[model samples]
Target: MHMQTKKNILFLFAAGVMLAGILGTSCKKDAAPDYGIPTITRVAQPLDSASIVTGSFTQWVIIYGTHLGSTQSVSFNDQEVPYKTIYASDSSVTVQIPRAIPKDVTNTVTVTTKGGKATFSFTTVIPPLQLTGMLNEYTAVGDTLILTGANFDLYGLDTTATSVTFTGGSTVNIAGGTASTLKVVVPASAQPGPVTVKGIAPLNISIATVAWYWDNRNFLFDMSNFNGWNGKTYLSSGPDPAPVNGPYFKVAKSWQGGWAWDPFCSNNCAMPAELVNDPAKYINYALKFEMYTPLNPPALPLKLYMVFNSGNFKEFFYDAGGGSYPYSTGGKWRTFTVPLSSWGNLQGFTFSNPIIMEFMLKDSNPSQSNFSICNFRMVPIN
Candidate 1:
């Protein structure tokens, strides 16, 4: 054979061998073996052995079983539960229950792995009870107290089964209730402290502190009627132009170097005789009022003066310009509550015989000075 032909034949043989090797490697496969269905032995806390039949939303739980190492997904109540794979193991998987569990469905936790899925049944409850506020926090014995909150079992689902107890005292009488409101009469012996309400059947408890008093009263001034304000000039009066619509008092101040306006309520304004006659009963009280400015005013200092029958006075200053108080209504009305205790010793001034209530406004800048006031009231603290 010629030398060139021999070389050509050898090159062709080598190329054929390389092609066969490439084909053989491409056809090779190492697929994972199929394991049998996974088994769920129990559901519990990660570090504790106590099994839980009911859990709140957004709670983390542990699933113990066989062949959970390859868990691909998890679901609660047939709804997909987002999870992380780092906590999955051959015998256990840790997952967080979905935060938005359907309120109307039964709860079932399902874990899916490479082998199969395992499901466990349980009850899922809503978020824990929260106390928002009260319609009236100050009440005397035999008075009805209205409490507002979430998940209170208020609808008389089991009238005799639900119980309300005042802390450090006996259970008070529950007059009526709904999901968000509970009406209870303050017992004569009930002390000033936290009140706890527990529901029936699937029991849930919520607690709130109430201010109870023997001589509780609300001295309300609905600024809509300005007849009682003596010798005071209001720039105008009409329906509240702000977002919180109601009757309001409008006072305008010019840029003055000193306090320019003082609005005073005369001593003849009707006040509870007990509040003025008994010093002990008036000690525990608070003053609440609503104030609004077209916008958050700059830090203009405003003062409240409590004039006494003895010619003595006490003063509390708040930044009408939204400085020190750190609270803003954002063009809405802002309700302020000042505890009597915050005023310290009032220089022996008798609160029961207050002669006047005055509002002082001072502005130094050229900007228009304006604000509205309403709902001035004094309420017992406890």
Candidate 2:
């Protein structure tokens, strides 16, 4: 190694380092991006990708724009909603509107990113207060008339207001309610027709009802009205929770006797043309009745299936969807519906001819049994 060669190498390396430093100084690196002031274009729903200017609280929506990839906060009408990083991106933030009732509704969706805050014109509205159905249409006076649906709480139904009007024009406030249910005692005068709900946003709403409060449409027989083929040995009046009709077919048996058809059978009876004409349509018709099984002692809280039959068709009642056998209402005179589709035999067993509708107890008993039931009418469920 020559000393001159070593000196030349050191000089070349120094020159290279100085040039690199000069270049680095001249070409400055870009400052870290703060994704300057987020931008929002339009909001849309995830399904069908439909653009929406307004949406229900708790509904999911996509906020479209730039700088959202670093979203620090997302809110619908100023109400912050929780979101996962996985569902957010620079161009979009997918979030659900907070269910909290809107107070000072600004009607805008806001997004805040590291850069700044941006907002799009959006209205977070309360879901429509819907009264789907009365749990038991024949709810007795002073009995709780429970109506089920969504957004009962959001509506903040001014119960004292004329929010709930019954069939007979009797307006009552909701006594109790949750998100999906509104309960009012059945007014002694409430009739049978469509009920009215005046306390809603934008416009008052009308709630359609099934047969209501002692309404007998395709009238079958009750204990007070049935063919006396089977004597009313078990006909009973309340001190049950409540009673809808005058007398109900309460099983006043040692129920250890189990399985028999005497008290439940109706003679070869005729049904309304609607119920008899199209057997295929029977699937849409429900056999509804007020039923109560005392859950406490002496009132045998046995799980029993309400075996019912019309002609050769045989089935039982439980949940509205049908056939939850060895079943009990647990308690209360709630109406029970058994879809005839469950009675596959009825699929073939329509009454172009006369037939017998009978009720029987199952041989399988919880050692003791008692259930009060009445108003067995076939009503259009659809």
Q: Relative to the true structure, how large is the alpha-carbon lDDT of every model?
A: 0.60, 0.67
What lDDT, from 0 to 1, does candidate 2 have? Answer: 0.67
Expressed as tens digits, the lDDT of each residue in 1-382 for candidate 1 is 9999999999999999999999988898967787658888888976788888777766788888898888888877755676553378888888777765353575777788889888888777656455544554444468776667665542232254566787566796577777677787878777645577666554344455443322123545444555555424652455554423245556555545445444434433334566677655655666766666655564223444343333555665544344543233466555456666676655355654334666555344333445666556676555
Model 1 stretches with alpha carbons more than 4 Å out: 31-217, 220-231, 235-248, 258-286, 292-314, 319-356, 362-368, 380-382
Q: How good is model 1 by TM-score? A: 0.43
Off by over 4 Å in 2: 1-33, 36-72, 75-96, 100-110, 116-129, 142-144, 155-159, 200-203, 228-231, 238-243, 252-270, 297-312, 317-331, 342-345, 352-354, 363-366
Q: What is the lDDT for 261 in model 1?
A: 49
RMSD to truth, every model: 12.0, 8.2
Best model per lDDT? 2
Tell me how many clashing residue pairs each candidate has: 4, 1
